[model samples]
Target: MVKGCSLSQNGSSSFPDPLLYRQLVGRLLYLTNTRLDISFVVQQLSQFMASPMINHHKTLTRVLRYLRGNPGQCLYYPENSPLHIKAFSDSDWATCPDTHKSISGYCTFLEDSLISWKSKKQTTISRSSSETKYRALALASCEIQWVTFILEDFQLHYTQPALLYYDNNSVRYIATNGVFHERTKHIKIDCHVVRECLQKKLFHLLPISTHD
Candidate 1:
């Protein structure tokens, strides 16, 4: 349901009655607590909750229809799965229609089960692809730290330097090396934080080819 809504529309609500729309959207957000599959879609819908338009309502209806059709479909965590933690992250460049801030999204898994994830609009507008990718890495770094803390609470020990997999080599390079090109000077904060995390051995970015 929420999955369909997320895949069906980009941001920018096309509907009306923003107050009512936001109320409904809020319900969806609340529902995401137990519905990890809907997290991405709920996050997408949340972006338009402020000033929903007619199109937004239509999109929301589509999500409802999808939910109606697949009420039984939901994420399942295996009881016997191992406690190993791993994370994957991706970002879209300048995805916002208004401010042009990129959207950073990532999902964390405990063995085969998803534990946490988010899709959010970045605070600073990025000037290039590298900046957006770096922002996503930094955001993922925060998630890694939280997950590590959670693991510690449970008395589970994940090896130091949690693995973070990304598809972009340039982003990987920025984290692995400190060479500051003129293009990435504007994104100094993101680069610095990511590098710091890397240096601390809190997480290491693993390069994966796009097709792989």
Candidate 2:
């Protein structure tokens, strides 16, 4: 998908054959298991499978061209890679022009290798960017838990805290600050998992620049 591009369900001429669109999108969805780079675009494109537009198919073809150019791209799990878990999370606030809902996405890495990831819209409207980010953080926190548990099952452990990076400064302050504030009350429920993970030293939250 294009940067800052938000596709709407309505408008544009509908594709003549929805089956072809569905088949192409389905194939792309399967590829996302290893082709993490195209996950976001594929997710966006898949939404219109039932009734794709010419614009959507054009975007899909663009993705196909990019994939053809990078045939060797893949997730590599090296034996020398450490077992530490690091996660990155972000949200596109009010990304959906129609519904005005946000989208939260996250990726979990086992040391230097990307092991798991996701890109999906939020379930509810976020009142602030902080809330959107914090919710994303919570989702990432859950992924970290599963990663750690699975690592433990394999008798592997990293003593250091699992590092979580997000681009929101408000999330950093909200997660770190214990003080109760009226501004944060509405989002208190969403912050619970993240704060608990912090208290237990499960994750070390870090704020990053989106531009970076």
Candidate 3:
């Protein structure tokens, strides 16, 4: 999908064949398992599978064109790369014009190689940008925990906590501090998970500039 392009169910022109749209999107969704670059766009297009519009079809064609232009693209892991796990979490708050739900995205790397990533809509609506960000952090924490477990099974262990980078300072503070506020009450339970992960040294939450 193009940057800053937003799609919704409210488009004026509907596609002629919903069946064809669903078939094409289903294939693209399968492709995302190995093609992380298309994951976000695939998620957005999958949302309209039930009733795609003409504009949605055009968007899907663009994705296909992008793929055709980069047929050799694939993830590569060098044999000598380090095994340390690092993650970056981010979210677009209330971005869905229809449901008002945020979109959460994260990418995990083993050294310099990208191993796991996701882009999905949140299950619940968040009242603030911080809440949405914290939710994304929580999700990333879960993913990191899973990755660590898998590594442990492979007899690989890290001496330090996995580094989790985020662009939201409020989320970093909420994960480290024990204080709670009225604005954050609804999200306290989610925040607690991240706090517990921190206390156990599962991961270290840090703030970074958005451009990085």
Candidate 4:
């Protein structure tokens, strides 16, 4: 999807073949298991499956073209990988122009090999970007815990705190500074998983450049 571009059910002619659109999108959904690059775009297009529009079809075609042009792109797991856990989580606040809801995404890596990831729309309306980032971080924390369980099953464990990168400094303060809690009262209590994880040494928060 184009940066700053928002798609909606309005202002477009409906696609002529809804079934074909659905089929193509279903294939794209399956491909997301390996083609992580297209996950966000597939999520956007899937929203209009019931009433797909011409613009949606055009976007889907572009994704397909990109995939065809880069068939070699795929998940690669290298040999002799170390037992390291790291993750990156982010959110686009109020990205859905029609609903004003946010989208959160996170991807985890074990020794530089991608393992788990997700892209989903937030259920509640977020009043601020900080709240959205907190939500995304909370979800990513849970995913990291799940990955830890898998590692334990292999008789392995990450001795160091999992490095979690986010693009917001406020989030780091919220998780690290107790005084920061007073300012974050507006944020929901459930969104403070980062704080708990930090105290328990489950993960270490790091600021990352948005462009990265």
TM-score of 4: 0.93
Candidate 3 contains a number of clashing pairs equal to 0
Per-residue lDDT tens digits of candidate 4, residues 151-205?
8888886678888999888877777887887777766464466677778888888
Better of 1 and 4 by TM-score: 4
Model 2 misplaced regions, further than 4 Å: 180-182, 209-212
Give the clashing residue pairs of candidate 3, or none: none
Candidate 1 colliding pairs, count:
10
Colliding pairs, model 2 = none
**Alpha-carbon RMSD of each model:** 3.6, 1.9, 1.7, 1.9
Question: Residue 32's C-alpha lDDT in candidate 2?
Answer: 92
lDDT of 2 by residue, 1-212 (tens): 67877788877898888899899999999999898899889888977877788888889889989999999987788879877889999887887877888888999988889999999888889987778877888899999988888888988865789999988777788888877423587777767888888899998988765563
lDDT of 3 by residue, 1-212 (tens): 77798899986599999999999999999999899989998999999988899999999999999999999999999989887889999999998989999999999999899999999999999988999988998899999989999989988876678999998767777777677433477987777778888989998787775553
Taken over the whole model, the C-alpha lDDT of each candidate is: 0.76, 0.85, 0.89, 0.87
Query: Which of the two candidates, 3 or 4, achieves a greater lDDT against the reference?
Result: 3
TM for every model, in the order presented, reads: 0.83, 0.92, 0.94, 0.93
Better of 1 and 2 by TM-score: 2
Clashing pairs in 1: 14-53, 14-54, 14-55, 14-56, 15-53, 15-54, 15-55, 15-56, 16-53, 16-54
The 10-residue segment of model 3 with minimum total lDDT is 174-183
Q: What residue pairs are clashing in model 4? A: none
